[model samples]
Target: MAADPPPPAEIPPAGPSSAATARAGTTPVHRLLPVIVPALAVGVASALVLLGISLLAEKLQDVLWGTVPDALSIGRHSSLWTIVVLTACGLVVGLLVRMVRGHADPDPATTGLVDPPLAPGVVPGLLLVTVLTLAGGISLGPENPITAANIALTCWLGRRFAPGTTAELWISLAAAGTIGALFGTPVAAALILSETLASHPGPGALWDRLFGPLAAGTAGALTMTLLAHPSFDLSLPPYTHPHWGDLLSSVVIALAGAVLGLTAVYAFPYAHRFFRALKHPVPALALGGLLLGLLGALGGHLTLFKGLDEVRVLAADPSGWSAGQFAVMAVVKTAALLIAATCGFRGGRIFPAVFVGVALGLCAHALFPSVPVALAVTCAVLGVLLAITRQGWLSLFTAAVLVGGAAVLPILCIASLPVWLLVTGRPQMQLHEDGTPLR
Candidate 1:
């Protein structure tokens, strides 16, 4: 849930933190304490900040849906209301960014599970617009912007209160904390950070390096759990035994998902170009909203919004949807994600991507009822995330965590190898140009 500005903020953990890192010859204890002492503090701060923004947005969304749509006498899920409401959201967001100073619009490309920290001053505008984005069913999530905001906030807090802590340390912790808050598990943050930490050179052991962020993630996850808990468990049937057929089918279905996701990756640049072609936020966003409304009309309300809840709905009763309907839902959701991101909407892509992948998985399962539904969904998620983000472990985590069972792990591991080879060198979904560039 980001989209703050141009040139994408470089996430702090891209490497080691200069500010709070261990000295070249320091003892292990020195590194450990430095991180441990401030771990809880950063995590709590991240949770509190995220909790406040989330509560504010949820209440605002309730009002928008409960009163505004009803008061307008337009059906909440009706085509007309979807069109008018989304178009209005675009207009208001565009005008705010245009007319207001510090409205905080970053490069939409980098607003996702990972993004560089933003300044605290930008927090207010971002919070304001992100709330509006969520309320208006903009096909985005709150992860990116909130993560960025927390990074900036933690950085500032570290410098002010804990003068000894490095900005990078705080940035990483804040990011970890936000991930915990978003996914309701510290594991999500830890898994995503594995690649980052593996490449880093430091004085401590790898686990030692991870200590602070993990601690922070645990705290943040707990805070979110107690306040507004979220779970990826879709209540699907447990896979008891691994069949030989499941392995082959998993590969096939997952590869199909990868192919599907690559379509969006290839289309992403073109979509961003088309929206920015207008060279004006007002018309661009308004038109994007209109297109999304058309999609919503076709796919229904289940396809709208960030998709966390919608994914559950699809999973709870996969057999209810015909194969064609599942296909429509996946395609429409992906298109909406592209439009919302390329246009001026503020949010992240991971949550929506997960939802789209689930739809694709469901479609595959429906097409071939012989394949285990959980297996298809798991592998499909792995494939799509691999193409979209090009991060293998994170993709593995999404697939593994969503199924909520260890029985699928061995098959997923084998499936990931071919999928990894297919997506190893693909270009990421990030845009290189914010404005018009040579096509």
Candidate 2:
């Protein structure tokens, strides 16, 4: 009104100082406090949910593999029973997928460790199929579905209560929580998330970005450890001395494992296309189960399911089997993993991949007898995981964890270099809906 109001004092956009002040306002404690509580809740919830589903699956597995067979006076894990149960499982899963909402999630082949939050309506069917897969001795694991379910639940609830928080935060917290529970360690969550979260743009240090996830991981890990008492160490003879020969053997075995895993990777898209050609879940999954049953019969019971216990069994008596037996087991497991993954099974490949690595490593040890068992196993595991998962840190961590020693670490680090080169830029095991490699 009066003299144009002095043209209004010109206000400047936020400069470096203002931005710094804004950043300062969100101090580590201040930023962490808001999400930490929710993160802890998510972590505990994720662990409990994982444990519940696992326990349920175990009970079902006991009935299917033990009680039913025992009552019927049939040999447990016999070939006939294996075929019957697997085929029945396929029919059940197929019926569920055909009848249930969300169809138990898109073909498992198209999913990965971390995916966008699924609809709440989809979670129950996903969980049911996951349970059936686990109990039915499917060659996959519970990681993908459990993680997906937790993420869905977390995001669904978080958005209702804390509308301001980003969906990414919920995803990180849920994934970290589930991974911690699954691996029984927050360190695994940190390692896995470091690879996934590195490129995410944010206004904080790496640790700052990891704060909520680490908290969730810690809670989930503690919950799982206290409840389940899981252990990854195989109690293999420790490797105390590092020699030139061991290094040479490690590199050689690791490269061989990489090549074997690459063969599967190359075959994955074709296998998926072959299954998808059927164009219906029922026949595709039923036929897949029949094939898995045949594989279980051929590989004995060791090649069935997600393979954690089978791996321990193999590790318990690495020398009990002939090199030929080990070779057959490794090859059968690789094929089983390929079939389970491509043919509409709802599980993870990592556990079965671990089994493959252990079998391959033992095969190497059985053949040579001079190489250290720990070194062979670690290197083989590193190579296989590197080729299949394409995760360097995880490959190294899993390899080191299985052996439970620092002595093999340097060798594994060195061995991974060449193996990494072999697998770099290769097509991943995952595929698109159109059956193209996900890469």
Candidate 3:
């Protein structure tokens, strides 16, 4: 199913609305009413926004794909076209950032863990720009914007009504719930939120904290279902059941994935810094696009865009490509992604990373002729991003979920084990407090 469109207007949470916060005399239950009502409001509003965004995205995609083949035919094969579109996208991003000046691009890593919430209006801008970039093939995904908008929308509503908990916690719950609904797995999103929150110090005990997100997740999931969001039934093909030996192979694959993940984390920050140092967003974006174009030239069109459609297409028909081409695709995609991240474009890194890993897994299966291609892709995706995101347990489960194969469960577990070992030690996510850099 196609993804729902993002929120329409960027609505930042109106600042503290007179920091008095829920009149000191209100009863506990009475106070609770504010949060509860707002939470529900957020769910409904966000769903509507997402639906609109999805429709817009579909229409936009039609225009883009229609023009793309013609552009390619006219010697626009080099990533120059991607760069041109992305540069224009960067300008749009810049214009919005300048206009609303909301949380720049609604960074994904910050959302899942409950970082301080942005003003309410932030969601719509993010939704609009992300839709524009993604639909235009700017090498990013909608997931970040989706999750960010959900969090922002909820927090905005919460602040308007509740004004009790720290805006930060509400923001976290908003993020958790949004992710939960989007993925159609509230448990996983809640776990991810809990684990992420645990990584840092905050008000409220684990149980107290879990209450909001659990409710939010339940609500979010309901919203997804009622709206018939495509993610409502996220499932991959079932692979052959895992054998004991497959577990051993998983360990090997996990280790490899972890290494890549860690490297990505370490490298991304530096790449981002390098481009920012260049100071000119246009030149930096153009340069990033040029590198992406070179990668596309080598990897074929598969490396182009955000790669979500490609992932779906590949999963549906894994037999379409030979191993060598898959391997090359993985390499080129990695380069393209690194370039995109380093550039000024704002979007999520996870999906693109998964795309690269999946292609690589397909290539590896071809070469080894032993491991199931699907299994290898699943393991690599979970293992690598777990390290990169610094969420081992979440990564492990996410990997298993991505594969959607009960038979491959053992293999997924095995792969995650070694990856876990390699990825030992909690890595801190870069977050901001009061909109200022924390690290």
Candidate 4:
């Protein structure tokens, strides 16, 4: 009874101060620890993973289509063959995902547009799948995989730094920065992140999220400059400058762009549903491939893939293309993208979207005969991008840089404003059943 009474003298609960004292007593103090631990670990891990995946994509591209007798032969392929290839790829992808759960076999329509950022553990597969899809004539681009990998890497690193505090936010910023670096415009990346990040929050939460974006973007830019990766291009034309006429024309062009952009938005979801209705990835994919082939049949091989070579060629030498050819290319390329995107092929709509804008812009320039080719192309590119992305500054920068001149910046920026307004006001796409924004 006496011992029980003594034990009843309650031990006071440990307070925060006591806990801190205990922690301080045991915590190791190594001055080199902080610097050595996070920087070395995150940096090296990110670099190795990114580089490995990048090399994998390159090698896979070579394995699939590098041995072509000629790049032009890409267009000469038959629609049936394209369909067959697409179906086979879809079959493989579906089979692969069959056993996996929680995003193992991503649906194409849901993959880039609707899905959240991928985890690092799944990035390699995402990269591999995309590379194969693109190489095999899927109407997609590298941007999806690039963005996926970037966010995945950041999430992986962030989790290591702090168990789970704001990991998704960090991942989002990393995604923006990576895209910005890839596109060679940090400002655009910031704008895209801002627009994409905006949500109806409780009062001050918006500002809270911005911090990670800024830091991530800064880090990404540093990485781009230091690494001297392919995305470091900042080329612009010195001689070019915007004329008053360019501004006026851009306004008109933006209206046209709004129509087309909205059309794409509307068509995209329906196309996705059409493919998904098939309920079988293989046949759906094959049908998409056949459609792609048929589309390419009209434009030749240049219309295949995500249209990078076409963009490159046009950027380098616009004279190689005629008005008719550009129009055909635009239609075919758009169709191919719609099919590939809606089907189970893993890829991005961004590049193909840009290409379509460029084509439309060039076509408008040709048909009108009043707008300068450069001005029209620049305006069209910005308009379409703005329509698709609903991002202001990013679209402005993209319009300027991709066209290679600051002169068009004024026109591009001015024109993009209205287009942004209109497109942004339109109904948000039903990218997911729950009405959430696609990644």
Q: Pick the candidate with the highest lDDT.
A: 2
Worst 10 residues of 2 by lDDT: 5-14
lDDT (CA) per prediction: 0.78, 0.85, 0.60, 0.58
Candidate 4 lDDT, tens digit per residue, 1-439? 1211111011111111123324444332221122223332333333344455555656765645444423545533555445555556666655544433434434545444313556566765666666667666666776666666765676666666665334444445556566545564456555665555554232224434344444444555556556745441123233275666777788887677667766766787778778778877667766776666567666776677676556766655555677788878877777777677776677777777677777777778768767776677767777776666665766677666665656766666678777776787664323554323243
- lDDT-superior candidate, 3 or 4: 3
lDDT of 2: 0.85
Error of 2 at 149 (Å): 0.5
Candidate 3: stretches off by over 4 Å: 1-37, 67-83, 91-113, 121-124, 200-208, 228-237, 426-439
Q: 343-370, model 1: which lDDT tens digit per residue? A: 8787888878888889988898899988
TM-score of each: 0.91, 0.94, 0.79, 0.77
Ranking by TM-score: 2, 1, 3, 4
Candidate number that wins on lDDT, 1 or 3: 1
Model 1 TM-score relative to the real fold:
0.91
Q: How close is candidate 4 to the true structure, as a TM-score?
A: 0.77
> lDDT per residue, candidate 3, 1-439, as tens digits?
2222222121122122223233566443443444454555555555566567766877886665556657567434445555555455556655655565564554333333334455666766777767766665656656567766666666666666665545554665566566666556667666776666555544335655455556666677677777765441124445777666677766776667666656655566666666667766566666666666566666777777777667776666666788888868776777666666557555666667777767767666767767776677787777667765666666666666666656766666656666766766644323221222222
Report the lDDT of model 2 for residue 324: 96
lDDT of 2 by residue, 1-439 (tens): 2211111111111111223326645555665666678878889999999999999999999999999999999988999999888888887888898888999887788788887788989999999999999999988889999998998999899888877666677888899899999999999988888886654444556787777888899899999999999888988999988998887899999998999898999999898889889988899889989999999999999999898888899999988999999999999989989988998988888888888999999999999999999998889988898888888888899889998889889999999999988999889888766677755
Query: What ranking of all candidate models by lDDT puts the best one first?
Result: 2, 1, 3, 4
How well does candidate 3 score on lDDT at residue 10? 19
Worst 10 residues of 3 by lDDT: 6-15
